[model samples]
Target chain A: MSVLEGINSKALKTGDLPPPSPSPNTFRIYSMRFCPAAQRALIYASVKKIPSEVININLQQKPDWYFTKNYKGQVPTLEHAEGKKLVIESAVIPEYLDDIFPETKILPSDPYEKVQQKLLLERLSDQLTPAFGRVFRAIKNPEELKEKFESILKAFEEAESLLEGAFYSGTSSPGFVDYLIYPSFQRVYWLTFLLEIFPLPSDNFPGPGYPKLSQWFKAITAIPEVAAASQSTENGVGSCKEYMKGLPYFDYGL
Target chain B: MSVLEGINSKALKTGDLPPPSPSPNTFRIYSMRFCPAAQRALIYASVKKIPSEVININLQQKPDWYFTKNYKGQVPTLEHAEGKKLVIESAVIPEYLDDIFPETKILPSDPYEKVQQKLLLERLSDQLTPAFGRVFRAIKNPEELKEKFESILKAFEEAESLLEGAFYSGTSSPGFVDYLIYPSFQRVYWLTFLLEIFPLPSDNFPGPGYPKLSQWFKAITAIPEVAAASQSTENGVGSCKEYMKGLPYFDYGL
Candidate 1:
């Protein structure tokens, strides 16, 4: 197998902090390979081709120092520059990167559009993310499971109406809103492959259920950087199995 | 008693929709005078002196049209010029106003500072809001209530560390961040008045216990517009009594 496929960098656990930022210019992301929120910043960084380095954290067994930087110790934190100024929160991480690197803009310059885009992300965070989570808990109860699926469908139905172009921002490119919400759908689609291991209902799956969302999903997957940044379903299945077994490993069941 | 204190401008309930936008420049806010999230946008707009009219919504009995504007039917939705562009979400409402009315800026101009300000707001939302909510639920349980109070304290301790100047942005003046978080503390402080009515443990009150937070709270309350925009604790007590009875009224014990 190619080394690229074989490369599954182990997550740094307690007492395993990554080396400091290479320089003031290069920012470091405290990320988890399988974490949806962490992948948000990763995809945004990759799409922008920002000078960034990744330090995958063992979210389960976080180092004490991690709390010093972020008391919550959530993944997708950004540390950069001479002061090593930290930016925590998934939404703000890429935002901070976008702020520092204004040349190739992913966020719309028009103020109304930008704030509206943020509103869209807020709606997704409120509705879609929870709807997706309910699916996992409702697996055994077929009716509740189906209801959760439809709820996710309804959120998409609204998105379908609002989606003017290929992406949320406009027709041409995926912007910050796309990246913010991308992880949720990406995780769902990848989880479909783990049906044998986890038994997520195949029939309940709402695939390309909405045309615009279909296009959006396909277009996002085609983005080379986003594709690289996202974990493969194989890796996903393996890590998920490990995560379920009380020991998560980023590598594909190594 | 003064006639001004009697004014609550009754909340528009089911089928009591407000009139159409008077002009392109004029804006409308769907608010609940007692709602903290709604108050966030209200304070921000007032502080910025944005030309806006408020139409308080009886959130418990929301008008159907409100859902058409915002599916979530959350209060503090901003309606503005031309297309009657709707800006939903408390944080986004002020941001939208800030964008449209840039002459009087509440948000920081610096990109890094702006994002950092947002991050601080995110932290408060994560920690303080829920902690306050827990206090309400844990009212009957002393141990749980005390733990919840400490959680609020810890969150404040972190805020104390970050708060150097008068506000989160700097020492000079309160900005968007201050407005964003103002409602939470405001609601908490106002809720204290209702303690006698609700039977919340009087001895457990961590009233301005922290020096920095005390100063920040005092400074936020000093802002003329912010003070004017917020509901009186008397009004809050009345609303809470009404809300507890399953019929909330904006008026102060009318």
Candidate 2:
């Protein structure tokens, strides 16, 4: 069978690929290098010790191969061992990785813990993503934009405080919640620092309002894996400003 | 123990509670009666044979208790046995149910099958909740409104087609995926049919575009557990239109 076929087939479990010796199947990741969603898949793959062939995609003009694999044309689609296939959306892919690799234990095992993890992750996706995406898009009047920044900072401050008592819920290392949420958090901070948009008149970041969060950001950047993930030239604040400029409908008042 | 204490303590175990005992210690569903999100919690409690106390929330007024339980103030907060507390987004609750009641086996046991199941459920949440939500809210829009409807219908049709040849792929009974997704589907159809928004010069309700989906809707609704969970209401589409009108800024281009 072909490599893609192996990926799309049932021959490979998510975490455990059949030994490369006999069939020597390879895993492939189709995504844009800097895309946060794509990075989620890559992060899991990296932690899982799985090597993947990364295909960086262009949003404006998608390649035919991408369309064949995923009609939706979104990034972070995966071709597994048997080539059975899965496509589109970042959050779902990481969950699939958790499913396949029970040994890795990226997701929590206890049902309630699992549920808590899932909900927290979803909040990151739903609340945090939408809020930041909206901010990045900068869709409101100046006063309105200022108000939103305050609101987002308030929410972020809460999350930062939540992280205070525990490295991860009192554990020594970052587990499911930390891994799932940190990429986006890092992205936000990088943008904020790069853009020099911190300490919004309404709400302050990198200040007393977000002391725990500010500290956590410092701690996260110290991690080698996180440092490696970022190649963004823009400082934390500059990235924030540049992110807004890159939005498709930046002028439309989201 | 008090209601709030039980949730935080994580004491609610599935079989630990003696087969649906009467109130206080029994299950209580804190939900908004009409919210699609709250429906997920209700449906699972119904399916798993867990008894719950129902708390009605008025989204407009913003209940104080709701804020206390969930800092975010969202409904579908579950207060269960043993002082176990869970408060987060709607999409995360079912996994909680499945975890406690392994016998019901709402999700698949095989690792690969689990991956497929998780992926499907997440996709359902994305397609049904936000993506379709945008379209449903735009019923009053002209060009943008039509575009939204087309996209929703397309998603519905695609999802319907994917479920061919099975009650569900991973399990014998309607497991997590079925129960999780059906509520949204149920609400969507009811809304469309009630509103007379169909045949809107853009698409047909159960037309060739969504024939398979129409069939699945009929089958899922017929299932006793799902059927019992639904409160037959005035047409959903009309109700949705009315709901939208009441909102401050829901004008569709004439």
Tens digits of per-residue lDDT for model 2 on B1-254? Answer: 11221111121222332223224566666665456777777777777766566655556655454565676777777766543565556666666666677776566776667667766777667776775677667767656776677666666766866775545454445676777788777666665554455542223335565665665566677776665554454433444656766842111111
lDDT of each: 0.71, 0.58
Per-residue lDDT of model 1, residues A104-169, tens digit only:
678877877787788778776777788768876675566676667777667667767778888887
Clashes of each: 0, 56
iRMS values in order, in angstroms? 1.7, 2.7
Docking class of 2: acceptable
RMSD of each: 4.2, 9.6
Q: Candidate 2 at B197: error in angstroms?
A: 6.2
Candidate 2, residue A223: CA error in Å? Answer: 2.7
What tens-digit string does per-residue lDDT give for candidate 1 at B113-147? Answer: 77777777877777888877887667667667767
Q: Please give the TM-score that candidate 1 achieves against the real structure.
A: 0.87
Model 1 ranges off by over 4 Å: A1-8, A137-150, A153-161, A196-208, B1-7, B138-158, B196-208
Error of 2 at A121 (Å): 3.2
- Cα displacement (angstroms), candidate 1, residue B228, comes to 1.8
